[model samples]
Target: MTYDLLIIGGGINGCAIAREAALHGLKVLLVERDDLAAHTSSASTKLIHGGLRYLEFYDFKLVAEALRERERLVKAAPHIIWPMRFVLPHGNAVRPWWMVRLGLYLYDFLGGKMTLARSRGLRSSDAAYTAPLKGGHKGFVYSDAFVDDARLTVLNAMDAAANGADVLVGIAVESARREDGVWRATLSDWRTVEARAIVNAAGPWVHEMLGSLGVNAASNVRLVKGSHIVVPKLYEGDHAYILQQPDRRIVFAIPYQGGTEIGTTDVPVERPEDAQIDDGEIAYLCEAANRHFTKQIAPGDVTSTWSGVRPLYDDGASEAKEVTRDYVLELDTNGPALLSIFGGKITTARHLAEEALGKLAAPLGFRAHPVTRARVFPGGAITDFPTFLTQVRQTWPFLGEKRAERMARAYGSMLAEMLAGVQSEADLGSDLGGGLTELEARWLHDREWARSPDDALMRRSKVGLHLTPAEHDRFSQHWAALFG
Candidate 1:
């Protein structure tokens, strides 16, 4: 099939671009080699945040761009993205107190309109907040946000598909060649698809993808592996902590899924798939938390670990940590115009998509209009979560408050569509372990392209976190039986 645009990679960037392109009246096709967000996009710190530390590297523009996108995401997907205060303890830190405060002030200012609270100082008397800290009498609190990163990516793909874009998962572009001013891409299964323009949003494999296309684009990807560990809950607050290590690298201890998630170690890697959390990275994360929190933890305390390679645009940075987090869009209009995306964060993906479309508009024969900027993702129509959740609970009393709230947050306005003609828990079909009903599982499969148990558990919904080993096995069996 011939498409106006063919996007490689189903990560946040690719999905966002697909949605944007489709919204602007383009026939777009997004193909991912693996499951949607099965890699780096899912492995993020799960925050829609401005890189506060990026200011140190004189990256004011990147921070401002990310902060603007951060605000947009919170408003656009309040279900998946919400503001969280980050506690940055002042004393016994790598950076000076003045510097930290100045940075926080700039962070609040850079983003323009503040939907969240500005930075403030926390006193020692605030025992509820200070009790968790091991040291440092004073601390500064600033706002960022938490997100279900995988779900965010999936929602973009969902919206793109809803807008008439073809989203094909588990399909790879094995080879591509310019044929009569169009990209003739061969899939892994030997099927061919043609597109007027091709977008290389392949994250870590940007260089490799270009190479496969036989395009001699500059290989500028610097693969930096960032690893995170999930451990037992460290503190009793809803707020998160950003601790400064002696090495000047900041690590986050976030309240996640009834546990604490501490990470990440920035280690330079040779390959894109080099996304394995090492022993040293785990220990470093544990130590980073133990140093600040009163409750000490070790490597043994880790319940889960995740890693992803950041495909930064190589600008001759000496260290991996020193690399720019900002995205670089390279447009090669020589033949069948190749738009290569080097580096980008989830927070700035929407804006990045807008920028990407702007570059491809003339070449791909489309008038680029910023439509997605005002639009929300699928199921993101509800702005007031609390009220929306209450309505969901009232509408489906059988779901109870907990389940209704979960549904409201996960599916938002689309909860009704999933629960249509259902009156009771019994009507939800089979109770797959951990509140994962047969109906919900089928919804994921039919609409979201969730083909396996892992896609349902890990990406579509986090119901797997509550499932027991035997229950997981049962779910797996049920999935195989239903799909196979």
Candidate 2:
């Protein structure tokens, strides 16, 4: 089919751009080789904030843009995105206490007007902040956000589909070229289509896609692999910790799936499939955790791990950590319109989309305004989460407190539709094990494009993390029985 825009990739950037373009009245078709956010988008440390460490490098513009977007995104999807506190202990080994305090001050200032609290210095003896730490070192408490990154991407794609854009997963744009004032593309399944423009938002495959399109830009991408390990719950608090490493790197310990998630060792890689955690990375993450945590952990203590290849814009930085986290949009208009995106984080995907559309819309003779900037996601209607959660529990007491809270956060205002006409547990169909009911699974499959068990278990919802081995098998059997 012919369209206004053909987007390649289903990561956060591609999905967000599709949503933005669809909102702007563009007939858009977005194709993904795999599921949405099956790569770098799902592999983030899952924080939506002004990068505190980025301030150390004096990247003020990036920090400011990210902070503003952070505020807007939380408002847009309070169900999946909300304010989270970060406790950064002052250890003078890497950065001096004064430097961190000064950075936090600038961070607070850069955030401009915000709904979250401002950063503050905490006394070393504050039990609430330092209860689980081995050392009573003073620290700073600051505001950022935690996001269901995969769900955020899915929601954006969902909204795009609702707004009249075509989103196809498990499909690939195998080849494309500009001709006759339009761009023609060949899909993996032998389908052909034409569009006024084509966008390359392929995360790790951006560079590769450009080669097939036969246009070279001045900039290239540097592949950096980041890995994280999930272990038993480290401490009992909603707040996460920012541990400064002796090598001038920082590691975060975030709470996830009834466990603590320690992450992200940046190592340069040659290929996208290099997205596998090495023993060295595992040991490094474990050691990083052992350094500050009162509970010591080893390799065996790790429950699971994940790795993603960050296709960062090549700035020629020698160190992986020093590479820019900012995104670059390259527009090639020699024949038809072509735009390629590089090096973006989940926090600023929407902002990146806005910028991408601004670059492409003018050249393609399209007229549209930025309506998504003020708009919230389909399920993001409530102003406060706790109060909305209480309302959810009250309405669906049969789901119980934990199930109600989980469904509320995952579906938000959409939960009502998901549970429409359900009066009792039996109405939800069978409890397919794992917090998934046959009805809920059907809703996800029909509405959210959950084609496989992993799509339902992992990306669309993290119910997979909480499932037992037998429950996982049961989920797969039920999925086959229903949709096969």
Candidate 3:
């Protein structure tokens, strides 16, 4: 079949592009080598933020773009994206309080009209904000939004499919060449397809994908690995903390699930697969947390870890941490058409999609008015998530408060469709542990293209983290029997 656009990659950028193109009345086909968000998209710091530290580098344009997208995403997906407050302590500070305050003022100003609260000072006597600190230090509190990064990618793909796009997983374009005013491509599954234009949103494999097509762009991708570790809960609050390391780098302590997730060391790596955390990364993260929280943590306290390679556009920055988070779209129209995406963060992916499609409109000879701006994602339609969540708990008491909340957040308004005629415990199917029911698992597989249980557990949901070792193994085995 000949398609209007063939998007190669299922990460946020690729999925978002597919969504935009499909919504514009184009025949879109998005193919991913693995499950959606199986890599960097699932391994984010998991925040829809404007990167307050970017102010230090005077990246006003990028910050403003990110902040605008942040508010839009929060309003669109309130269930998966919750407004979170982050505390930045002044003690043992890298940047002075005056400088930090000034930067935050710029941040708020760049954000323009926003529904989120503005930054403020935190006094030492404010125990709720200072109780977890080593010295009960005075600090600053600011607002940003937290996100479920993986589900964001999945929902985009679901939306694309709903709009008549063909979303394929575990498939790749093995080889391709532009011919007869179209790109003829062969898939890993041994099928040939044609498209008027191609998007190399292969992310970390951007350069490699170009090499495979025997094409070249003026830009290159630099792989930087960012790692995070999850430890037992650090404090009693819904808020998160932004800690300053002596290296002038920043680390975040966000309350996640039942643990305090701390992260993100900036280390340059040679390849995309170098996603494993070394002993030094673990030690650095543990020490970063120990320097602030009264409830200290050691490497042994870490319950889980995740790592992802940022495919940053090489800007010749001397240090890895100084690399730009802003994206660059390289459009090479030598033959049919090719657009390669590089260096983007999750917070601005939706905007990036709009920009990407706009860049391709003239080259691909297609244009339809943008519909993604006002369109809420598949399950993100309700006005008030908390109120809707309370209604969910009251309507389906069988799901228990926690499970109901989890489903409500992951699927939002779509949760009701997933539960359709379910009334009692037995109607929902077998309890597969980790709050996963057989019905929900089937829904993820049949509807969401969850090929494996791990896709449902790790990406679409973090249910794997809640499952005990035995339950995890048993559930995987059961899934293999049923779906494999």
Candidate 4:
């Protein structure tokens, strides 16, 4: 079947573009080589932030764009995206106090009319803020939002499918060529699909897709490998910390899934698949954390490590951290229209989608309108998540406070739909542990394009963090039996 747009990549960009285009009444098809967010989208610092450090490089435009998108995303998916307070402790070694304050002021101003709290100072004696930090250190607290990045991508894909777009996962576009005013793409499974326009949102494999189509892109993609480590809870609070290394690079210590997640070293990578965290990166991260927090961490303390290669737009920066995080969209309307996307962060993905569809509207002959702003995702209908949580607990008294809240956060407005007809805990079926019920897993597999147990465990939900090895085996067996 012929389509108006064929998107190659199931990452945030591809899925988001599909949602926007499909919402605009376009016949959109989005195919991904692996599970949704099997790569970079799931491996983020999990922040819907405005790139606070970008101010140092004078990336005002990017920061402003990100901040605007950040606001929209929080509104769009209140279930997955919520306000987070990040504390940046002042040290004599890093940027001066006056400079830091100026940058914070600019960040808040550029964001413009945000629901989150404004930046403020924390005195040295502020016990709650400075308890984990080195003694006599002052700090500043700023607001951003945290997100379930993988879910964000999945929800967009779901929205696209709901709007009559074809969402295919675990299928790679093996080749593509312009044929008689249309682009024919060959899938890995040997199926051929034709489209009026194509989008190369393939992330790291963008250039490879271009090569397959015989289009030599002028812009280059710089593969930068960023790795993060998950360690035991470093601090007692819900607030996250931003630590500055001697190299002027920033590392985050965010409270995640009953633990602390840190690291994300910006090392240049030669190959996209070479996203392994080296010993040096682990050591560097541990040392960076050790310098700031009173609680010291060693390499052995690390419980988990994850790495993702960023397909950043190459600007000839000396260091990986110095490279720009802004996206670049290249449209080649020369035969069958082809639009290529390079370099974008999760915070700005929805805006990128709107911009991408706007560019393709004329060539693809589609009426474009803004829909995602007003339309909420499947589980993001509620305005007040806290009140909704209380109601969820009241209705389902069988679930404890933590379990009910986790369910509400993960499924949001869909929690009731997912838990429909379940009158008691036993009715929910086997506890796969970590509040993950067999019924919930089935729903994810049946509805959310979850193919394997790992997809549900690691990406769809972070229940893997709470599951033991034996429980994981049980989950795997149960998921296989249910799906296979």
- On TM-score, the candidate that comes out on top is 3
Q: 1-484 in candidate 1: lDDT tens per residue? A: 8999999999999999999998998999999989999999999999999999899999999999999888888888888888998888875688778888898889989989978999989976767677888775688989999999999999999999998999888889999999997999999878899999999999999988888988877649899999999989988989998999898999999998889999888999999878998988988998888889889998988888889998988889999899998888999998989999999899999999999999998997778888977788878888698888878878889887667777788898888899989988899988777888889989999999998899999888888877788989999999988888
Alpha-carbon lDDT, every model? 0.89, 0.90, 0.91, 0.90
Deviation from native of the Cα of residue 261 in model 2, angstroms: 0.8
Regarding TM-score, does 1 or 3 come out ahead?
A: 3
Q: What TM-score number comes out for model 1?
A: 0.98
Per-residue lDDT of 371-481 in model 2, one digit per residue for the tens?
788799979998898999999888889998788888999999999898889999889998877768999999989998889999999888788888888889988999999
Model 2 pairs in collision: none
Q: For each candidate, C-alpha RMSD in Å?
A: 1.2, 1.2, 1.0, 1.3
Report the lDDT tens digits of candidate 4 across residue range 71-167: 8888888999999999898863488989999999999999999888999898656677788888565779899988999999999999999999998
Q: Which residue pairs come into collision in candidate 4?
A: none
Query: How many clashes (backbone atoms < 3 Å, residues ≥3 apart in a chain or on different chains) does model 4 have?
Result: 0
Give the C-alpha lDDT of model 3: 0.91
Per-residue alpha-carbon lDDT of model 3 for 1-484, expressed as tens digits? 9998999999999999999988888899999999999999999999999999887777899999999998899988888998999999987798887899999889999999999999989965678889889765577999999999999999899999999999999999898898998999999999999998999999899999998888978998889999999999999989999999999999999999899999998999999999889999999999998899888889998999999999999999999999999999999899888999999999989889999889888987777566888789989988999899999998899999889988999999998899989989889887776879899999999888899878989888789999888999998987887688
Badly placed stretches (over 4 Å) of model 3 are none
